[model samples]
Target: MGSSPSTLERHGYTVVRELGQAVLVNSKDGDQCVIKKINLREETGKGSGNTDVCDAVETLLGLSHPHIVKHKTAFADDEYMYIVSEYCSGGDLYQKIKEQSEKREAFSEEQILDWILKICMALKYLHDLNVQHGDLQPKNIFFTEYGMIRLGEFGEFNERARQAGSTKDGALSYISPEILDGKTHDEKSDIWALGCVLYELCMLKSAFSAESTVKLIPKILNGSYPPLPHNISHNLQQLIEETLQTDPGKRPLAGEIIWKPFVLSFLTARSEKSIDELNDNLVKLRALADGLEKVHYGATVGSLTGGVIGAAGGITSIVGLILAPFTLGASLIVTGVGVGVAVAGGATAGISNITNMVNQSTDRKNIRSIILEFQEKMNSVVICLQHITEGMEELKHQISLKNEQQSPSGGTIVKVGTRVSRGLGAVPELVRLLQVANMGKVAAQAARAVRVAEVATGVFSAFFVALDVFFIAMDAKEIHNIRTTKASEADDMKSKLVLQSPEATDSDSGADQEPKSETMKFVKKIRETADELQMSLDELKEIISFIPKLPDIDA
Candidate 1:
């Protein structure tokens, strides 16, 4: 092994190995530790601020928290500052996410909430101390044994880097829009970065992705990203939306995020109950009751309504845009008018749902009946969801068949009404299901019941987006079909010419073909739609997992 840095060597630390950005060292006391070597020559070369750099490193040694990495000591030589912190054996969050991404697996919603809450708690501690982690990304989020989060690589090192005009440019994907816009870093900016982290944990990819920093700046400023995988909870999705808001003022502070109803309830359930207690559904129910007691019932209903209306409106708007060109300006006008009407109708429906919830809440004695009724409706919704998924799968199969058939003449025309747009038929069914669940939520006492309802609504919302994409995919497939037909005609002519040649053999007849851009585009659409639908189906199946097995009742 290479010799330890002089700063570490003075402390009787030997270099065990070199890590990517730090050194793994063995202390004389027989403990494995990490020594982060920060070069201080650049800052001191200006002939000042050496004392300030030392003071910054010293401050981190005094910081302590359950979720913060434990710093043992800090010392500096003339050229470098070395800080020793406890080594986290379980690796970091970035590695875990990368592994899961490679495996094509996703973290469960409960697991995601657990991780984010721990991170939020750590962040709140830092914020309360008037400290901001200028650099917060998955790589800096370490984990101890049993997967407890220990925030690392924070404090003076980050501050110094920021002062040196190096604010984690490598982690541009996680940088907040405000920072990209040249605003000073603040706690709110940390919230924005955390949102990016949260999105990564859920989707296994950076929320904002681009080929270059120049392309990425506009993306972050615009702050629009593809939706989270459908298997993620709507509440979680909503939380992410709030956190990633481009307007720093709108983002929730770390403390407020910790206290959100979903976070609080989920954390309580995990911390307050043993696996055995959770297995006894009634105990789980009791725990859920206590957790949700702090939740605002009306707000929950309102959020559900908001999600529903937002999804419906987005779908209608997309539909209008898709059909606008066909009608010239008339369809655009109609779409504008239709969207206004839909918004009005959706608002009225939301108010009605809230009113029903209020009326139902007054009758606590009817809780069991209310849950049973909700459960019954959920059964039907589950069947409806399955039917919809199956229909989409069949539609995909039909498209695949169309893609495979090599017609020399014009390709078989898709039936007029056979477009994936017909998937819209499930919208009203889903709406009615939401209304029933809304009524059930008002009267139900258990968080599980509420979660099932939320998941159902989330499935509907995800499906709506899928339906919109499905339309675009169908259009792409139509173009692809026409192009393939023309290409096939040319190929058929070539094959005929080859067959007429005296020297032609089976091998001679085969020619290598170049990739077609339209075919690739269509294939990409197919993959996207399939992936999207599969993810949504996985989310829908989670409802089955959430629904408890009730005792059989006498007829």
Candidate 2:
């Protein structure tokens, strides 16, 4: 946007349109993209500047996902840097929504659900990588050809600009209350924005619309909004309500939202396929966790045994060289022991939280509470794993330093350190595997909880075949009871009538036979449905059990 199309052409892109500070461009290969031009010197307020923008762009370039608008490449001239990314032809969701509103139309329930699901999937992906989309709104949601949506306009440039003390514009209505109150935001803030976008889609207006930002802040902080239409389903109403809670802790995570009854009802076949793939990934993760548990246990035992043996052979004599291997081994073992204890504690807390969640799931009010606890515990587990990995690396560095020291025992220490390093080398990889497994486990549990809740709530769809069977059986039982009652009354009447006339007996017999036949068919249906429901419950239990049980590291 800053440079002419001819200037940009020399850099290999034909400018199409200017979007804010970014310009839409077409390459020689006919690839359409949006190029963000950053004037490094102007941004840094210097004659020449560092490569912070360049480094940030490189990080963004590494991110690739279906819902995330892909960053293709980056290059820079002396004064300006250009970052290129995929361009969406259908424009942004905000523009589309504005056009629809102009036509006096609101997005249907199915359309809103589809867009929300796609956005949540992208947010979940980014959150897993610890990247927060600080600015999320309808304008950031770009529609591709065929109406597929991708999240764009992430705050990378804004973030860098802010670091240099520049102001960045954001939509006030879509910002979370926490952010408005001068608090740092995380993934939950994005979820809050999601709630606002969804509300707009349904109502054809903003939830916290105001004449000015000054008025909007008060409404967001107070969590006030126009009530949803009475015709909106209770499930959807509940979801939006919880997401817009003023307290960030009360909001359900992006991962948890996917499993809500309202969201699950609109899941497409492709969504189911993704769930299956996720299931497979979780299974692989559990196996990885199992292997890591074993390694952790082995390392702890090895460290403790080595330390005791080394201490027993005193290091106060010339024979310390003979005991050098034992000493080095003890140092490595001590490191492992420290890591093991931390991991064990974290695992124990996570299990406790999960158990509480499972127990309290029936209480809708308590669902958010349990999720908050679970999220906190999982965060602790991740921190513990990260610490363990860092500690192992530090241990390796220390051993290397020791090996460099000039001493008669240096050779022995080097030899022992090398062996120990090799043994502990896999610790980082194991930690990484567990971290990934934990994420998968969280998503799986959330999905399972949703399915179970659907059955309990009587929302029977094709996806819930077992639940449908159970409901059908209940309906048959009710019909059978009604028919049986009618048949009994007819028998009583027939007894009275037979005393008066023999003709009534013949007619009553046919009616009585029909009721008996109908009752038998209904009974059969009830039995079949009951069996199917049981099978479904059994299958669900198996899926829940697949959530990897972290070893009692505390023990």
lDDT of 2 by residue, 276-329 (tens): 443443343233223222322222222222211112211112113322222211
- For each of the candidates, give the backbone clash count: 0, 2
In angstroms, give how far residue 300 of model 2 lies from its true place. 77
lDDT of 2: 0.53
- Residue 17 in model 2: shift from native, Å? 3.1
Stretches > 4 Å off in candidate 1: 1-7, 46-48, 155-169, 274-555
Q: Point out the worst 10-residue segment of candidate 1 by lDDT.
A: 546-555
Q: Can you give the TM-score per candidate against the true fold?
A: 0.48, 0.48
For model 1, state the Cα shift of residue 264 in Å.
1.3
User: Which candidate number would show the highest lDDT if scored against the true structure?
Assistant: 1
TM-score of 1: 0.48
